[model samples]
Target chain A: MDTATVKKIAKYLHLAELEKREVPRITLQYPELSVEEAYEIQEHLVQIKLEHGHNIVGPKMGLTSQAKMKQMGVDEPIYGYVFDHMVKSGQEISLSDYIHPKVEAEIAFILGKDLEGTNVTIHQVLDATEYITPALEIIDSRYENFNFTLPDVIADNASSSGVLFGTLLQPPHKLELDLIGVTLLINGHTRDLGAGAAVLGHPAKSVAMLANMLGRRGLKLKAGQVILTGGITGAIQFEAKDTVSAKFAGIGSVDFVVKE
Target chain B: MHDLISEKAARFSAHLEQAELMGQGVEPLTSLDPQITIKEAYEVQLATIQKKLDTGRRVVGKKIGLTSIAMQKLLGVDQPDYGHLLDDMVVGNGETISFSRLLQPKVEGEIAFVLKRDLIGPNVSALDVILATDFVLPALEIVDSRVKDWQIKLQDTIADNASSGLFVLGGKPVKPTDIDLTQIGMVLYRNGEIMNTGVGAAALGNPAACVAWLANKLFEFGIILRAGEVILSGALSAAVNAEPGDHFSARLAHLGEVSVHFNPV
Candidate 1:
């Protein structure tokens, strides 16, 4: 991967995220962009955040399902770091923080132990988890009109922006994880519905994917971090002042008022 | 020899002693000093474990976690990881464990190897593992994270004592030869309802292979699996959530069953 390309793209995406601006897809500028290079761009972005005094809280996995993998022509999921600035848990999110904001419901895991290595499993994920919660991830892609390839999106931190956590924290043992149900509501009306299985068969596996990815990088999922598994349903675009809530069958619900 | 890594280990020891939360990720500690390598992560973990040992915690055996393909694939690894099991981490079968004592725990169903002979490695193999084992019994590892929110990586888990929390032994014990280690099956139940199921092949082909993996890994640290130690082979099924007022049980073919109750917190 070209280190200069990673720095250049990281700068573009970082500033876009800050100034709430949209830019042309990087692949258009660098058609030769590859998946590994895209992730390198993402890694640089994480460094940029850390340098700017923003902490890396945890990681989020994207494009986990086979359908998305097939759509993107990739065999695995992409990941991005969750920043402290990218959250509004149970609070109102100002639309001004983003450009053409959209939302997705996800299952998030808070690990109790460090989860990483080549041999991590969903079973081990549960063993490492502190609690499981429902999440509402607010995304505003830096790419113009959100038109980007898998690599392009990966460079943009999988379009991840803000997150709102559900208060209901359930230990993994008591819940039927595979059967966990999710309902997305917008402005007091139902918009989408899915289940934990929607996230790579089980949401825990998505987290396991993160551990493995980090493990390969010689990085482990750190303890005291939070991870938002990939979206449970397709992204739903919404406008300012829309009251949106995502309800998990057993883990409870998290809602936020989106306003400009 | 960065102060940050060693400093964090001291802080980690304080947290584990009180069953409290670890303050921050060790990434910053390593990031601050490039001299720190992957080897340092294990040292930090060992430092914390040594604190527990200094306070009178005795090592009972060890555990190999993440032995399944899905788990190995998820962590991008081709092998499992190991952690020390302490005497106090053991939970008596059919006993009610206080939920408050644990910092967000999940229970995994696995086979525990009660060894009758010391097995040292670097040269350890599955055949050696089976030969040294005295009996195999069903057990549940109550894995907990003192690191707040459990946002850990392999380094973090390794340093955090393999995330070993509490464990339980079952009513039945079977010899390693009594059952085909790879062919044995298990059913996990939560509140009298079946939740998940799996076969021993999930533990890296054969559950004994996990024991071998552990022994070999420990050899890097000049450790050996001694007689009378009980090693927890990786989970036969995915770990399940544990909550107060819940009765959970797991039964392994030929190995009988183990049960635990989480008292309301």
Candidate 2:
């Protein structure tokens, strides 16, 4: 939990991701990793990405589902950033570029106005949202076999790796935010299907919670930032020659092919 | 040639209207005329609806049917069909409806979109439907078939006005932007017991997509969905048979609940 320890763990996780290899869970070594400390480590890890010239595209939420929260024994969702280098679209993803990648379908929101405050309401989140679109997140956890404690995953940037977005964007006020349906397909077959309510009842609520969480640190979501709400469907593992596509009802589809 | 088509449409419409008025099921129009195309069916539907409008009843909105894959497969159709919602078809929530007024009634739970602006579309998208929507409400549609034994092909159902009957709307109105329409869960209770359950995605993926499809389909007929019209997107689940004395309630997540009671004969 000390500054030096946080930096060390941050570097360790960063190197694991960079080397495309899995490492032991951080909590396995520390045994007493606090959530606050885990986030501190995450900050340092993001700082490392920044130092490496990666731009912060926006933050993403993890464990936003009630089932996931209960499984993780957490009362709230976790946050991590998506770096500019991690934002991908319309491109083939090399399997060697990640440790072990899994894909999940999500709804992404682009903010039109700044949202700041501890009491940010879901309405405020909706009001500030400029566009909503379908998103596909490729999460590659650096922990061994994708296994990690909540703190371990938190410090690993919520297992954030890469994101691809659909081009279809509609204003938040023009959509039924909670009802957007998504079907995750791999190689043209349905793998998983879910709706926007999978993300904390409503996708907007996830953004609201994120905003309030950031507000605690005197941070705010600025205009034009893309926020990937948590996955609506469970993440499915993919391999070389697999094509992952997310089809969102009323929105559009986002897809990419995995290559060796 | 057009006159012959109009003549046939008028005759079929009158026959269907007569069956509806007498609360008696009639033979399918497709059985009467196997050559009846979807367009001709729509003309028949409009002719029948126009009769009601002439009788002082008003056009309340529109309804899309056969949206779910289950329903589409059941009807041997690959796409959805639609109908007009007349003012006379509005049933008050919780109101007991006389059994004599309905013939072979079946119930379906759906989300109703109340438009805030006119949607005249030759190219309406789901986003257009959402932006035009003011709010959405939970609804129960009592679908009755004029075609005997519920035997219907796409054309037969279209000619029968997509089996439009009576509908009850929930009181709670949530803004379209405020809720997720695709994932809203619905529980249909018949006689105080759960009969069916579904989510908004059952209707053409998202219910709003149903509305969008309806708007564009209507454009071919030169019909525009106007502001203040309540559009019943589509059924969230397969229709359940409605028996006399049955009390049916549909509880939609975030949108609230709507119910109707059939009068004991």
Candidate 3:
């Protein structure tokens, strides 16, 4: 695709988000835009935000689930950005700024050592040791009436909306993770069950992959940053006026209520 | 005479305010056609969102959808999909969502990452992921779509913000080497009863691999994952439906837990 066309598309998307309204569809009028073209537009969009006082925070990985790939009919994963404006403490959430949103259960970690650009092993992730916590993420979209495609969503930042962090816990070294269990409750009902192993068989490995992924981009995982390991239990759909909570066996739990 | 002009202006102002309010409150629109090629529609949809970012809207983070193996097969694909997040979509945990704007909204349990350094793409290794990250936390991702009943193709989901909605973050931060993530177990409790159970392996055989995949892919585009960014890897299990007054929770063995609640609209 032409650079001008890419910019035009980027410009339209920016307008639609600002209006909080959807724009009429535009025909690409060409085959798929080259990856470079797509990213060029993305870079311009990033700059536009910086000009508006929005700060860049970090990068997020998408499609970490092999199962999700099989469902999406793709073999590879995609990614997007996380800005300063979207992050929030678990206890301080406002109700008026979001559309429909849901939460997930996950294991979170902080990087204690610098993971430079290179192949990272699980052992290294463990050697960098710090502490661990639980977390919840809230997602909302900007599409008019909230409609979009996979590519559209990717370009839009993987629908990352809000996040919540939980208490920290560090188990004794050499402890077996299979002995741990998490209980998820929705509206006073048990909705799902899972363990840390559900995330690609191990959450640290997930961290390891993140380290290596960043390395290729000439980046490194710094100390004191947090990373969510992915869902351990299944997801539950939510509506206005609902209360949800998750409890980790022998650890802690996090909960919140939805308001109109 | 003077009063007449003032009255006319007042009426115009009222009308404009009403129009804007009405427009702002309208439900999200969805195509009536089921046969629309999701892939084609996604390309167009992405272009439009990019336009929004180009103008002023900010890029918040990324979201992963359908991390479950069942979902992958349901869409007749072999891998997970992704989408973007804007500054405006985030909300606190336990916040009510406007159903009117979403076709079908669901929830998932996931792990989220916050990076402390810049991460570029092109063959990023798992070690790089460890180095780039600052903290890892538990999260709940709300998957909502404008497509009726969450009906969509893989491409459709990719465009629709990866069915991204809202997320809640809680818990303490730990270093990657602090625990054995592969053997991590999770149990979900809704209200007071058990609902679901899973492990981290469900996320692309290992959530780390997912990170590796994302890094290599981004490298192809010359884009980099900067420090202090948050990434929601993907769902670890199936999606659970939620309604008002419902409470959900997920607990990870050794890591801790997270939860959210819905209230009456």
Candidate 4:
């Protein structure tokens, strides 16, 4: 994609998020959008967010689950950023901030040191992790009806929106990363459930892939940054006044309520 | 009631401090006073630590004891107890320590957190600990009970500063976020032979959580874990007895190794 087209799409998606309005997929207009071009658009969108005074919290992964990967027809996952403004916990989530949001359970890694290099392994990722905790990611695709192609989703920052972290912080070494069981509850009822293995066998693997991907662009995961390892369970749509919670075995639980 | 508590705390503190100064293990505080509460035990500990501070010994850090679930269960306690670390108690890595100075010393491998920010809490979370930590290092805590024969109950040990003795910190410092602390494997060697092996999870599932627990628990006592303090999370495995001429070294994966030698009598 040309610089002009990428900027146009980036501005369009930024407007979609800021204005709480949904638009058609970017691929619908630029069917030939390559993954690299999509990432370029994402970078531009991140730049726009920075210009608007939003600081980057860290990166997040998308389509890490086997089911999601299979459905998306991809062998790997996509990466995006989480802004500091998107972090919300211990407070009600106002629905006015989103167009149509869905919530999913996740394991978020907080780094103690910098993770860099193209050959970053899962072990390295684990080594760099200070701790892990249960997290709830609120994904609101700027694309209409949450429908989008791979490039379209990537360009939209993998629907990065809001994140709520659990109180429990555990060392990754102490956890059986692939076996952590999670239950997603909506309005006090179990809506969906999954395990940490859903995220590319182990959530750390998603982080490793993300680090290696960013390494290609000379970027790195910094210490004290929170990396949301993608959703473990399927995303469930939520609306105003709905209470959503995600409970992770041994890790603890995180919950939030939506308010209009 | 407050005066009685303070009186008992002062008496027990003097008793334990005398034993420490004389290099002799004394009777357990609980044995002397069966009615001693955990709260009172901590008061005794603070009193003794205050004595050390009066003598110009600075507070260096803190140590959490009985972090493992099994150890907690064995002691019939749901949580770990803490002790103060004095500046004089630090042994340099690879340095030889005098055996005659310690009574009934036992060594355990641990991860030490070096904080860069104050962790004041009633609600300090594990993430707060990680953020406040400047780095993590491999550590060897040489625990010694002022109580005779190490026959200590939870209160007894807590009153004796959780059996605080000497600690040796490794040189290689890594950020807490850089490695999976729960998975860090430890191989404790005594005189070049493996004595025990364990993982970071052995310390209350994750050592960082142990620190978090300590910070929150300390809030009740009006204590804040200040920056620059070295907080020993807890032992990762069973502590091995340290005898005269014994050389103990702990090899912690990723964090590196720390060792201390006991001088021959």
Top candidate by lDDT: 4
Q: Give each model's whole-structure lDDT.
A: 0.79, 0.87, 0.60, 0.88
- The fnat of each candidate, in order, is 0.00, 0.06, 0.41, 0.00
User: What digit string (tens of lDDT, one per residue) describes model 3 on residues B1-265?
Assistant: 0112233233322332332244331122223334545444444445545655767877666666666667887988886666666776665555555544333457677777777877777777767887787877777776766444565677556645566666765556766666644435655566745455565655764566666666675555455676766777777667788776667776665556777776645
lDDT of 3 at A31: 38
| Docking class of predicted structure 4 | incorrect
Better of 1 and 3 by lDDT: 1
Tell me the tens digit of each residue's lDDT in model 4 across B1-265.
1223477789999899778778888988888989999988999988888877878999999999999766787889998999999999999999999887799999999999999999998988888999999999999999999998998999999999999999999859999888777656566779986665556766776789999999998899888999999999999878899999999998776677899999998
Ten-residue stretch with the least lDDT total in model 4 chain A: A189-198
lDDT of 3 by residue, A1-260 (tens): 66676667777766655554544433233336444454455556666667778765544445555555556565544445556676675544555546545566766666677766679887887777576666666655555444554555555555556666667567424544433556566776656656655555566767777778667667677776666656666545566567777766445777777665
What TM-score would chain A of each candidate receive against the reference chain A? 0.96, 0.98, 0.77, 0.97
Q: Global lDDT for candidate 1?
A: 0.79
Best by TM-score: 2
In model 2, where do residues sit more than 4 Å from their true spots?
Answer: B1-265
Best by DockQ: 3
